[model samples]
Target: MSFTVNARKITLSLLIGSSSLMLFACGSSGSDSSAPAPVAPPAPPPATPPSSGASDTNELIKVNQLGFYPASQKIAIVPDNGATEFSVLNSDGVSVLDGELSQANTWDMDGRSVRMADFSALSTSGTYTIEVDGVSASNPFSISSDVYSDAHDTVLKAYYFNRASTALDAQYAGDWQRPTAHPDTQVLVHASAASEQRPEGFVLSSPKGWYDAGDYNKYIVNSGISTYTLLAAYENYSDFYQTRSLNIPESDNALPDIIDEILWNLTWMQTMQDPNDGGVYHKLTTLNFEGAVMPHEATAQRYVVQKSTSAALNFAAVSAQASRIFSSIDSLSALSSELQSAALSAWQWAQQNPDVPYIQPSDVFTGRYDDTNFNDEFSWAAVELFLLTEDTQFLDQYLSLNVPATTPSWPQVGTLGMLSLLNNGKELLSEAQYANVQDKVLGFANQILAEQGNAYQVGMTRSDLIWGSNSNGLNKAIVLLHAAQHTSGDAKPYVDAAVNFVDYVLGRNPTDYSYVTGLGSKPPLDIHHRQSYADNVAAPVPGFVAGGAQPGQQDNCSYPSSQPARSYLDDWCSYSTNEITINWNAPMVYMLAAMESAN
Candidate 1:
């Protein structure tokens, strides 16, 4: 999350997907056959030794909102002009504050300017400045605190609730906002109270990215992808943890309150089910409660089972976990069985429709299906379902399926797919089947390594390497390293590649913990570059554009017409709150578990 760039510690940012980077321009290596070999350039000058003049030189500094807004609020002493060092220091004295900006390099320095270092901490409220040598900037320049905001605080608390317990809403959050398109939409569903209270596994919700109504009989429901995920998490928290029996702490009530939200989600998900098929529905449109909501084959969207059912199954797991503590089982069994059945049906459908491209009227997957998560969904669903049902046949079919060796240019999501293969494939499939799956999965990893070229160090630009492009390549590398943890066969090279990718990304944007860097519909080439999430906008730099030059630019988010992502550069090293809570934590835990299990 944090990096040491130029002799100072700075935070980094999070990335959405991996980048296929072409970092250094392909120019003459200066090894001409006709000319003599060129000598290596002299190393840059070393940093000016800490001013030897005095232990505390009396130098006063003032804030000037010269180039940017918010003024020089939290500027700290950096190594100035050297690579390979970083740290966050205090004003008047070089006291280091254990802050995220000290770790992430990207936010620490905004294109030759260190503006992100100017913010109030969440725990303590004050304005302090950073000092270099004996000179001190205005003390009003620095601020430190533990709490970011009320809303962020609530979100973080709910996230940890899922992490500590059985991933109550985590699965839904993971599958709903899936990084890429893969089959598994048909079976994914939201959690029901039964599942949340005494979960056996996950539930069946409609495809992510849509809203969920409280109706279970309706085949299709209208929903917003992100909101449904948030609502589900909150509802699950309240269902089991909010009760007086749990004795949640006053200050830590955020977790229990979130459980209440999950319970609401269960009731809401049930209400959205189609009475006829017993399938979950997306909730994004207005409906007349009095009339018949028939299944409109062409209008109704279907996606892979995992996208549709993981939320529901996750609820089951939550229920199962909570029941262990609260002693509630008979109350939750029937609904749990129903959710389990729905998820099973969706999985069967996926097995039957391997070649189906998008989430079509006949298919379960909704929205765009051409993404990295597609294969991942299949592997995850198959493994989970196989475990729940003990259906070796399912494992056979999953192993037999010929997943394409191809992976999208996007690295973050693609890397996840690789992890899924590594985790689920080995967990469920037989030795032979696992080997086969590994063969196919390795092809995808190799594909990225091939494109990386010299950028192998940084790997590829997550979304795109050019200007304003957001890249998840570092994340992809993380997943790859995880996958490589088990099994053997040239995995070391892949692991090395992943490490290099992380190093390069962290080196360039040291302050950002998340390593993400793009906004709008696609990745940005630089800080100033801009792009829209909807229409195809002009790329500021020639030959620099992301998502290709295709017509009808897709929103950065999979959902249509979603708001463009904003670039908050300073994210490197605060904590793994958001990233770990959602994308990073589960997968990291799952991967580490697999590694430990293997050992």
Candidate 2:
């Protein structure tokens, strides 16, 4: 097997010795070193409107509704109803483990005063529930070694559900099969994207990429981060993903399933690049948004809009990064060469036309992923190029800007550069340079933990509950986990905080619902996904992470509350709260794959 061939392996345990992390108390993996001392938790926030009071008695206790990995942290948020202890009961109604609850702490924004119940001491494999003496029992959960395996595959398969330009065969998609849509062999070249070689209305053959979101379109800027995150996961966890098969059309190929799915989009991304000048189109789409209908029914003319510096630099970054990894395998030598050539061409174009932004035409009314700032894009492109070639000029460009790292998103991608560097830059940097890089990474992780004093005890803060807050929470966890993996000393505090953030998205927050569409005790059936709505599937597409709660209420749906964490609406009209996208699911895939590989 080629599982162990890739470079760069780290051997840090996931939160080895936190007070609440005894999932490995009976195990033999003493390979884990001792972790950092626990930070002194801040005083509890005052009980107020945005936070629930001590006397309130609504069902707000939340845990990971799916289950636990048996060798990781296990925690549940319980209401402060004078309960001092909690117990784990087996499915047949027998008590198995008990633990004292932490002091009552009020969440500053989500409106819940709660105590923590950590039953990680229980490692027996069985279905169970957490029960507080005076409060309602929690949703039933299980403890097992293989708790996340199926979820790892299901969430990644969601990419297949979002594919364009091909009919989904019944053998692969089962009931979700549908006809082909948007075969872009005749994509019109818009006037803004025109040149002498290819005038306006040029019919070009550009086909195959996943739909950017619930809307049926392809965007290079959004695809850039989503694709890079998945590739980053593979680069770090190559051993776990080598032979891990996803039963898509290319499952039987010699390449790994993740690479196969990624290639499906990468090929389309390549077509978006113009051979004449190397500028990449920002998006390939119809003039307007389509109505709720099947893929074949909503027939419309598609066009490739204006080329942008953001899209070109993103293309440069992803392609250069991919070329390096593919070159590692002898079988992919040809693809490696081709991707690098495309990347170099894109980099050249970006250098020449460095300020182009996406200007949506007057007639087009689809999603606009416009960004005016290119500092992060430039930094990320330089870093990936440096990694691919080990050129000091590229390294100098990266060092000159000194952009700060944060939780990565489509528009804000400076952190992606830091993550890739942390993974591959150690052997290339001097002693001081590497140390400075490490400090920046760890400093961001420390800031995240220091700011997250809410009752949930996760890594998100009051300002983080914006649109797609779930992705922010998961991306924050990714940062914390990477900090733990790459830093030197006891890594327990960072790892523990990361695990709690994962628990938050899986159903430990104020909403009391698993943010994932499926695979939890309480999941949303009415997601704002066009395919799920038009297909008449009784269940929404499986394994999607919803946008999560925000006070914006942009969709103006019937929301239960106006509080930031409680603004979620699980109906078709609530696009702000319930919509799903590739960028959101990408981090979910990364987190699950990382934890599964760690186990």
Q: Which candidate number maximizes lDDT?
A: 2
Q: Residue-wise lDDT of candidate 1 within 143-237, one digit each (tens)?
A: 32211122123222322232111222324332211122211234423222112332323333432221111111122211111222333222222
The residue ranges of model 2 lying beyond 4 angstroms of the native Cα positions read 1-8, 13-60
Give TM-scores for every candidate, taking all chains together and pairing residue i with residue i: 0.39, 0.92
lDDT of 2 by residue, 1-599 (tens): 00111364566744322111110100100111121121332223344543333445558568988778776678899977777888899999999888899988877666656788988888888899988866777888878777777888888999998899999988998888888987879999988888998899999998899987777778899889999988987887787788888789999988889988989899899999999999999989877777767777768899999999999999999999999989987988899999999998999999999999887777766666777889899999999999999988888988998989777888889889988888888889998888878888899999998976767888776557766788888898889888888778767677778878778888888888988877788888887777888896798888888888776665556888776777788887777678888899899888887777766
Q: How does candidate 2 score on lDDT?
A: 0.80
In candidate 2 the C-alpha lDDT for residue 289 amounts to 72
Best by TM-score: 2
Report lDDT (CA) for all predictions: 0.30, 0.80
TM-score attained by model 2: 0.92
Q: To one decimal, what is the Cα RMSD in angstroms of model 1 from the true structure?
A: 17.2
